[model samples]
Target: MGGRFQSLREPVFRQWFFSSVLSASGTMTQGVAVSVLVYRLTDSGIAVGWMTTCTFVPLFLFGSYAGALVDRIGPRRVLLVTQTLLATLSGLLAVLTATGAEQMWMLYAIAAISGTVSAADASARQVYVIDLVGADRVSNAVALNEIVVNGSRILGPAIGGAALGLWGVWACCALNAASFLPPLIVVLRHKTKTVTHPHTQKIGGLRYVWRNPTIRVCVLLAAASGMLFSLNVPLTPFTTAIFHLDGTGFGLMMATFGIGSLPGVLLAAAGPSRPSGLRVAVLAVATGVAILATAYAPTVTLAFVGVAVTGCASIWFISLANTLVQLESDPGMRGRVMAVWGMALPGFSVVTGPFIGWVGGVTDARLGFGVAGIAMILAAATGWRGLARPTARTPVTSGASRA
Candidate 1:
């Protein structure tokens, strides 16, 4: 165990670990704060759905462009600007809520702006990890990042729930917003570094992805899997509707999922260095199966257990898929490739949010969960061949060769 632990002690991994811890905690807190605030103000399921959509829609719309920008300007500078903007946005939201002057539209507008920044920020962050750790340890680094992020998923919601109960949503938002300061400060203190990439023909990142068969398949898989995974967003409302629960119940459910994800992260971290695409495909399929089982869970306890398994499988698939993308992409186009990945990851949710909500609105929330699971299973099964094949090499320019 000690030897295993020591292997993760590289400087780049250390930096990535710390950064992920701070950012993940902040993000989780922000999620709880936003959900509680919107639910309180509107008390409407659709409103909550829209709030979730607001966070994801920008990623879908602008993620590719953001990736291109990350490559052009470098990820370090991009992180500085986006993290600062996110912190400021959080503070503004805190003030609005604290003043009792908060309106629904104001929340919507703020969410949209924040979402735009997140798209770019996320792309830059993904590419930055490769630059920080180099390609060799990218898989381990990604798994460690997942561990941190999911760990936050465990801690942040618990803290947010307590804060929301004791101090109200305004205070939670204030604290959540302030959480970004640590990462921003950490980024600012680091010296600027150059990221080299191969100069490729300027094309939309999504277009570039479409041209690569393996990448294209992975992107499509990510999109379908993303939609399935996102059922949790709407699942909160479903739980409330069925169990007649409150914010605390929602928090507990998220916490349960978080708990389940921790072991998955560790497992992924401890797994083989080079993971095959088939492993990722299997994980995706397993995630869908877990969700399918959860849909039939008669008790909240059973549902929690089901979600926990789903969390484990989902994170494993995501971490592996992400690792594959980073490893296989040309460094020059890495930012764009990651952005394309990001776009597919979150973009589908934006379009599916209202649709899922409508599904819940029309029939039952479980139906939405069922549909999402089925879609993922079908997608994985269909794309199995592409995913199973080894990645093909593309011609690289001199700059890309160095990268």
Candidate 2:
């Protein structure tokens, strides 16, 4: 137990992690408010979908560029600027909401801005954790990072809904705007002294990903997870068509999946923080099987068990892959690597939801889950040899290596 959280003993990571939890919670809360508000304003579900799209599209478009920027400018500098920009953007949203000047076009513009900021922020914050903790605890830190993100995701919506009911959307926006303060302050006051390396040239993120077999596997897994675990699209069919249940039943299935993730992450954290290809492969395969079981369950009660198992396997795969990417990449190019790596999530978000829904629409919801499981199984097979091989990684004392 003590070993699982040894990373928290580092003061920088402790503060940063604590601040990130609150910031992420606020961000999620604001997301709920934005979605609800946009739907109300436009009275269109499609419009709301577009609003969500606006928030993720920038990463798919310019994520690599943003990451390269992080490496050149330094992650700390990037975080300081990006944090302020996001806070100001949140404030701008509040102003627009309160002043009755909010429009669909304006909301979209803000979403796009938020997405762009998020792209830079993702790479910066990820690479900065390396700067803070060095090599030894990077895996633990990455696992902890996932816990914060997933935990906050689970809570943020409910909190945002309550705020919306009591104080309204503007209040949610305002509170979200304020939520950025702790991290911003923490970053601003963060001081580090480290040796510098003279860089003669820069390497493209994709080039490194291609050259490194481990990183390539990690990225593939990341991308594939996005497509496979897009299980939400098939839930309606599973609940209504298969289980003959109501909306509340559908919510139960979703919540069970989310609840299951907590244990998966915790288990991963408790284990080795170091990259293990076998672990990733096993988890991927297990997740696929769980998806199949959930799809073919004889009863709703059994389906919940499958959902929970799927959740546990999903996070285990993700956190392990993320840790591998961080550990394997050269510190000099970590930002670009993480940037390219981060795109996997959003990439699938845009494509898989509707694609999976269509699969369920054409065939049965069970088949869609089966197909996703097969895809995952196939993807895992490709990495079996690579993951089975033991590889050595060099640890860094500073954030970067000397040239």
lDDT digits (tens) for residues 131-152 of candidate 1: 5655655677788777777678
1-403, model 2: which lDDT tens digit per residue?
7777878888878888998998899898998999988988989988987887898889878888888888777788889989898989998998988888899999999999989999999999988887787777777888888778777877788889899999888888888889899998878777654323336136788888888877888787777777555556678787888889898888888888888988877777777757687888888888888888878999889989998988888887888878878887776777888998878776556776677777888998788666677767888899777766775574654642212
Best by TM-score: 2
Clashes of each: 1, 0
lDDT, candidates in the order shown: 0.76, 0.80
Which pairs clash (backbone N, Cα, C closer than 3 Å) in model 2? none
Please give the lDDT score for candidate 2: 0.80
Worst 10 residues of 1 by lDDT: 394-403
Q: What value does the lDDT take at residue 322 in candidate 2?
A: 87
**TM-score for each candidate, following the candidate numbering:** 0.86, 0.94
